[model samples]
Target chain A: MNLVANFGPGRPRVEQRRRRGQTPRAEILDAAGELFTTNGYANTSTRVVADAVGIRQASLYHHFAAKDDILDALLVETIAAPLELAERLRDVREPTPARLYALAWFDVRQLCAARWNLGALYLLPELRTERFAAFRLRRDELRGHYETLAAAVLAEAGGAGIVGAAALPFRLVEMVINMRSDEGSAPVFAERTIPEAALRVLGWPGDLDALRGRAQLLLAQLEPA
Target chain B: MNLVANFGPGRPRVEQRRRRGQTPRAEILDAAGELFTTNGYANTSTRVVADAVGIRQASLYHHFAAKDDILDALLVETIAAPLELAERLRDVREPTPARLYALAWFDVRQLCAARWNLGALYLLPELRTERFAAFRLRRDELRGHYETLAAAVLAEAGGAGIVGAAALPFRLVEMVINMRSDEGSAPVFAERTIPEAALRVLGWPGDLDALRGRAQLLLAQLEPA
Candidate 1:
């Protein structure tokens, strides 16, 4: 069943024709992402993912030892870019609203544009198990960043924030995942409309039109070229 | 496993013992709701549900022809009261914002207070199949009510609604499911914070405290005594 093989031990270059990624690992993730999001994580087997990628189950194991590993890898991929952006945005010399808007914009774009609706898998009860603790912690860290930025927005508005107010901006961004689930895809306006709504929920009395322009500039400067 | 029999045809009261619900049907739904929310719908078999309820598999089938039927029943249960409330709230002579807040308040309360986090099951990929079409339609109708009310709120503010603005209130209320999943429960502040955020996102240029008082009165008057 080997389409191509690399001459190495343990590193077995079993490139059985690229499917979605440049490597076998990527192909496995692509297949698993589809199955986990569509057929469900509990119902999809490692063998099914291997078959979808045209690789032997053992070869699939060479990259990811278990189905959980594939899921973990996919989850990490979703948050990695945004987490990095959130980290970088923290030090940028921009207004709090602009920074928050940029983070929401980047996050919503990724959630809506991903090949699979991976965020829909976030509620998989399996995630509660200890195996996914690292993923959970990383997600929490991302949420923490959102809270910090949102708190700044509330403070800038000179309004004492309501309970859970800081959390709403993050939640507003999360709505795109459910919206995508229902509508088959996110509406084109989601990228703009969601960020604006995020700021509004914080009672940001600043000019949104001005905020949007600055946020777009920050994104253009900070996003990887 | 039967503890008691109902003495009827097709309605065999094989009520071995009640776990949560009083009737055999209600008992099945309770067990299924727990299993589906915690263990996941795909992994929980009808036999497992019956075992948990101390009933025979045959008895379970007598009540629900298939597993999907049980899921459909549970999903319908989650939406039934809220949908009815939304319908009743539609004609109430309150201000548009108060009606929207009340709808969000009622919806979020149920989502948080359900015996099980049944709303978590809403994302199951199996739900996309034709078997659950009725549930999907019913849920959509509920969303339509939210959108109509939200549109009125936006229009009253004279802020021409942004694309997809009307859908945010429903999405905001829906966030409680994910919040519940993350924290293992929704916090006490969720009911008030979420609905307020829903209105804030729509730029409801009105006094929230006054609106809250009105919405609470509406709930008191309209919700069954």
Candidate 2:
């Protein structure tokens, strides 16, 4: 094991110094996420990301082969935690409304709290391309989880007959992206309001206060210590 | 008037032939709309738009001074009708819920029925710059209208103290943009469900069926012949 590995296969690679992340890859993603979100993804270039990261272009290529790979990594990072939570929530034996609320709450909080508005990337026309198919598939799976939870909530609320009601909870959580876009910040009321609104739209007849308590408890129990 | 006026300041400008619209400007907008919505705004150039319209780049300049101008025109067009309707609905004698419902229904229908998904452009980071301030202000005005109507609906529904309940209806209607983004079409349930959901999230306790009837009548009265 070499004590000092160069950043990449280039002449005189600079040491990774004072970037936000623990490693070169994290530093690159940090720069790319900022540039992509604020400067527009289509408009950002690898050179620019490298410049931002204080890395040479060849060094960036060493870590990620292309701009798409960097973007894919960032996109995947945004969804991975929530998707894991959603998957874990599936195995938890709780009321459907509480489960649904926890999912929306946790998802909205992340969307709101991320360092950059990476959720905004979901609107990129580039996402329609096959290059991002895996990211798209993962997003679909997450949406499926939200829909299943929503459907169960509707059934419990006697609204199973309401066609398309299941679709709104996922859409409601996603609305945080737009909300952040408009307000230039995490919407102040998002965590408190969106989860409740998601249930309300599904015709969940339970008191939101009680549902909030149960959902909070579920999230605490499931969250890693 | 000259019968054979040149399309622009250049030798042998081609006459406007069969395009989507009667005039060259409209035709240019039609083509740009398609290209911007399908390909993307940043990815498209005025030259590409000119080629799509089967015109010279100089002629395209005669119609739109810059690509930003074309986008500004499109952005303004998307909000103009709905803003007008929202303004007019303010004067109509109907319950607040019905008026709000009509505004949402009309907005959702336009978003869903447009020849292109221009609403998707609203998320463009370019809009954050000063160049698009007018369009942004108009959208804020539209949101303000929704919030005002929503607040009234809540007041009547006994949830007046519910902070931020008014914000969700506008956000809910805007979700149609995201739905279209994911699904690659106007979501089938958007026009029918979004308007109702907007009211439902606001704690509207009235029968949706009854509100729908009044809102429909209100729209019929306000719409131009």
Candidate 3:
């Protein structure tokens, strides 16, 4: 007998309802994320997000307690992907520092793309309370995750000898990611210029090569010479 | 003094009234800049600034017109200081690239301290509008000023050969200034770290004890044997 078949009366119905509930919840979050990124958080409203998802604002309330909750969920989902990627890289046996660093970079880039509104959120102190604690907590966790990876890379790459006095490559990555998340001006230039700058900072040999080549060179440096 | 004594009837009285009016206008900006930096642009009110200056909110309108106008005045003053400094540096006959770079760093640090809210203003798209056109224009002008300085420094340093990558140093300086303006977290570390990073990126040697020695070495490299 299947485990599903062994369920009591209404249990299957309850499970089906739960799954149904999740789809729209996820849909609302998707719409909210898009709106929050396009319009500044202060300017975005609950009604607008509901409209984007083709639902009543009251229906949105059933899923999200408030707009802040939607932002919290977005932050959680946005950061979770990169955190998981970092964890996965950490668990990989015999992973080179370069490979790990590249993974970290890609993870951050993905996070930047997914939650571009985070820049505005980070700038505003008022939005960082109560329900939004999770956003800050997850962000801190992400920073710690990247810091660990950067420390590992530095350890392998002769620790400050390669990156110079500022140990700036790490800071450069952080700055570039922050800059890319900026929606106000020249975002396209930021997106293009930052990755190239990151490659240069990593001491990758070639000038503006394919992403794979750049990653390989950077990661190879983290391996034992 | 003779011309003033021989002036038409009431000219002195009119000039005195105009000067009195200017005092409150300047006072409004000083209060606004202080309030905006300590408590963010959105959180600040013209009423609060007026109260701080011991004037009625309606009286503030007599001096400034609107809140955005006050902000525009503050931003223009904030941006103009650095450009003025750059101009002063330019007048000195062919200041060495190292001196020019150092001056730029010092000028930016001063401005960062004076205008911490400018970072928050730039990050918030809600603040950008036709009303804040002066802010945007001055911001772009500041960037152009940096680019022009970078070009001069690169040329003086004999281009990319001596500087490794001429554009990289300028980018590093920009990153340092940006990081310094971030008041939310690790500001002190960012301030200390970025200037040293800029010096290193400029290939001016990493040892703090040997800053003068390093500058000399860099100059020799720029000037050649």
TM-scores, each model vs. reference: 0.93, 0.93, 0.66
User: Candidate 2 chain A, which ten residues in sequence have the lowest lDDT sum?
Assistant: A1-10
RMSD of 1: 2.8
Candidates, ranked, lDDT: 1, 2, 3
| Model 1 chain A lDDT-worst window of ten | A1-10
DockQ of each: 0.74, 0.61, 0.15
Q: Write the per-residue lDDT of candidate 3 for residues B1-225, one digit (tens) a residue.
A: 212121322122222221112466776777786667556666778988876666657677876878888877776765576666555555555444544454445544654555344544555554445777666676666556555655655555443322233334434544543444332433544434444444433334335334534444543434211
On the 0 to 100 scale, the lDDT of residue A66 in model 1 is: 88
lDDT of 2 by residue, A130-225 (tens): 999989999999999999998888888886223577889888888888888888885688897889888888887678888889999999988532
lDDT of 2 by residue, B1-225 (tens): 323345554455455463588777888899998888878888999998987777778888887889999999999888888889999999888889899999999988888877878888877889899999988999999999998999888888887223577888888887888888888875687787888888888877668888889989998989633
Q: How are the candidates ranked when ordered by DockQ, highest leading? A: 1, 2, 3
TM-score of chain B of each: 0.91, 0.90, 0.61
Candidate by candidate, in order, the iRMS in Å equals 1.4, 1.7, 5.8
Q: Mind giving the per-residue lDDT tens digits that candidate 1 earns over B155-176?
A: 8877844556888888888888
> Between which residue pairs do clashes occur in model 2?
none
What residue runs in model 1 are displaced by over 4 Å at the alpha carbon? A1-18, B1-18, B160-162
Please list the Cα RMSD from the true structure of every candidate, rounded to 1 decimal place. Answer: 2.8, 4.2, 10.6
- The sequence of per-residue lDDT tens digits that candidate 1 reaches over residues A50-169 is 878877788888888888999999999889988999999998888888999999999999999899999998989898989999999999999999999999888887784466788888
The lDDT leader among the candidates is 1
